[model samples]
Target: MRVAISRCLLGDNCRYNGKTKPNAAVIRSAKNVEVVPVCPESAGKLPIPRPAAEQRDGGVYMSDGTDVTRQFQAGACKEFDRVKKSGAPLAILKAKSPSCGSDLIYDGTYSGTLTAGDGVFTRLLKQEGITVATETMVEEMHPSVEHPVAIVLGTGLGSITDLVHVVRRIDYHDIEGFPDNAQPIEGHRFEAAIGALDGVPVIVYPGRIHLYRGYSAAEVTSLVRHAFRLGCRDIIFAGATGAIPGKVEKGLGILTDQINLTGRNPLAEWEGLRDVESPFVDMNDLYSPYMSSIARGVAKDQNITIGAGVFAGVLGPSFETRAEVSALRQLGVSYVGMSTVNEVIMAHALGMHVLGLTLAANYSGGCDVDHQSVLATAKRYEDDFQRWVRGIVHLL
Candidate 1:
C-alpha cells in the first residue's frame, strides 16, 4: 500500500505556522502502507511556515493578493506525478486544507466556509485517478467496532466457496443457473454466509444489467434501494472489467474514486429527495476509507496485487476507439470500464457507504480486442478476486 499524503498531516513541520495536523489514524494507516508525503506549498518553492493563502478563480493568492495559484497548481502536479510513480493503491490526504481537502473544501476566499467541492490538489489527484481519501472519514467509519466479515465470489463458480452458510443469492436474469427476476434466490448459500458470518447481513446481486441490457435507470436504481433497505450500511460492487490505456494493468484489482464522463446517471430520475441539491453526488471523496482499510488489510494478508486508482465509467455496449481511450487517459482515468461508478453514486446519494472493486479482465482494445483473452484472464484469476471479496467480508 503506497499512500500519497499531505506533508502537514505526516508531521513534516512544514505548515504555514510551522505546525502539522499529524493525525493518529493517519500515522497508523501510513505505517500499514508506504507514505508519499507532499506539500504543494513547498513544491511551489514557498518557504517553510509561509504566509497563509487562499484560492481565487484564477489561482491561489497570498493575503496581499500576490498570485500563487499557478505555483500551487504546478507544485500539486509535481507531487501528483511523483506519487503516481510509487504505484501505491491508496492515498490518505488532509481534508479542508487548501491543497488536500476531499469533499468540503475551502471556498477559496479563506472565509472558513466549506463549499460543495474539493481542493486544488484533491481535484488534480482525482483527475489522475488516485483513490483519494481524508483522515477524518476513515476514523468515523472504521471505529474499533468488532463486525463479522465474509468473502463472496461472483459468476458461476462464485456461488460455491469456503463458507459455513449461504446468505442470499441474486440472479438478475432468470436462467437455469439462476432462479428468478425480482425475488430470485433470496437467502441462498452465498448471501447466507454474508449474513451468518459478517453479522452485517451480506447479499449478492449477481449478473448486473448493463447499458446493453436495455434496463431503465430507475429500474437499476431500485437495486441500490433494496440493498440499503436490507439494513446493509455499506455496499461494495465487485466485478470484472477491461483496463484502459495507461491507467491499469490487466489481471489486477482497481478501487475506483468517481465517474461522470458517461452521459447516464442513476439519480437522474429520482424524485422526492431535495435533501441533496443535485442527483449527482460529489465524488471527490467517492470510495470510502472504511471499506478501503479492509481492502488494504486483506490485500496485504493474501498477497494480492491490489491496485487502487480512479476508474472512469463509460456508457458502453461498445468499447472505446483508440482516440477515445487516449482522450480518457488524458482526462486522468486510470481504468475504463462499464459498471460500478453509477451504482456507487446512487449508493452515496442514498446515504449508504459504497466501495467498488474492478478486476482488470484485459487491456482495452487499443491495439488488440480479444474477448477470448478477457474471458480467459477472468477465469484464471477468479479465485484471487474471490479471496479479495472474502477479505472485505471478514473485515466488515
Candidate 2:
C-alpha cells in the first residue's frame, strides 16, 4: 500500500511558521506501508517556510487576507497529481488544517471552531478518488471485522404489483413522489442510504444521481464526499440498465467490470480554485476482485445467473429504440443506463473499492420492449433481487 501522507504530520518543519504536528499513526503506518510525504502548500510552489492561511468569504487565503487562495489551490493540485503518479492506494491528511482537513476545516473565523468545510486539498483529493482518512478515523477503523452489509433500494424497481404476501407496505403516494419524480433525500441522499446500512456495518450506495438532472459539478462530487465521511473505504453500486440488442446477454444481471462514460469528467477543471492536482482518478483495477469473488459465490448459492461485462452510460429518461441499441452495441455497451457511471467513477477516483452490478430489466426496444412489461419484469424479480442482495451484503 503506497500511501500519500501530509508533510506537516511527518514532522517536517513546513508549517507557515516552521512548526510540525508529528502524527504518531503516520509513523506507525510508515513501518508497514510505503509512506509518501506531501505538503500541498509546498507542492503548489509555496516556499517550505510560508505564511499561515485561512478560508474567507468564498476562498482560502492568507491570514491578512492578501488572497493567496490561488497559490494554495495550485499547490494542492500539484501534490495530488504527484500522488496519482506514485499509484498510492490511500492518503492520510491532517484534520482541520487549511491544507488537508478531510472535512470540518476551520472556517477562517480564527475562533478555534470547525465548520462543514473541506480543506482545499481535501476536496480536490476526493474528486480524484484517493482514499482520504483523517487521524481520528484511522484509529477507529484500525480493527477489521466482518459485519452485515446493508443494501438500500432506491427508485426504478418493480412496483408493489403483487401485494399478496406483503404484510408491511410504505405508501409511496403520500411520500412526495412515489413512482416517478422521487428524489430520495436530495443533498442528504447518501446519508439517508448510509443510515439504512448503519447498524449493518458494511455501507453500500446502490444507485445515485444521474448527471443529466442539470446538477452542478460540486453537487455530484458530494456523493463521494459524504461516503468518505461515513467511514466507507469501499462502495458497491447495483444499477438498473437497458440491455442493448444482439449483445449476447440481455435482461439479465450484468456485473460490469468497466464503464465508458463520454460526457464531462468531474475533475477536468479547477483554475486554481481548490487545492489538489489533476482530477484524473485512476480507472485501472476499479473493480474489487475480492468483492467479485463474493458476488459470484452468492450467485452460486442463490442459483441466480449473472453476466460480467461493460456498462455504457448515456443521458436518459427517453428509452432507446432499435437503432440506438445497435449503435450502443458497436460502442461496446452490453448494458446502457443513465446512472451509476459517475458514482462509480467518483468512488474509484477516491481510492474506494468499487464494484458495479446492473440489474437489466429489459432489452432496449429492438422489437419487443414495453414500459408496462419492463415494470412487471422488475417487479417479478424483486424478491429474487432482494435475496441475492442480502447474500452479497453479508459477504461484504
The clash count for each model shown is 18, 9
In model 2, the Cα lDDT at residue 30 comes to 56
- The weakest ten consecutive residues by lDDT in model 2 span 158-167
**TM-scores for all candidates?**
0.57, 0.51
- Measure candidate 1: CA RMSD: 7.9
Relative to the true structure, candidate 2 reaches a TM of: 0.51
Best-fitting candidate, scored by TM-score: 1
Question: Which portions of model 2 miss their true places by more than 4 Å?
Answer: 1-154, 157-199, 203-207, 269-273, 367-373
Worst 10 residues of 1 by lDDT: 143-152
lDDT per residue (tens digit) for residues 29-77 in model 1: 6665556888877787776666677666746777667777777788788
lDDT of each: 0.63, 0.61
**Model 2 agreement with the true structure over 1-396: per-residue lDDT tens digits:** 466888878788877787887877566655655678889887766664555678878787666656778888898888888888987656788888787987688888777788887888878777886667777655433322332132323344422112113222333222221223436432113223222321235443433455567654444445454555546665556656777667746544645455555475655432222555665556776666445645665666678877766787776657787777777778777887766666666666666665566667777765555556555666667776666655655434
lDDT of 2: 0.61
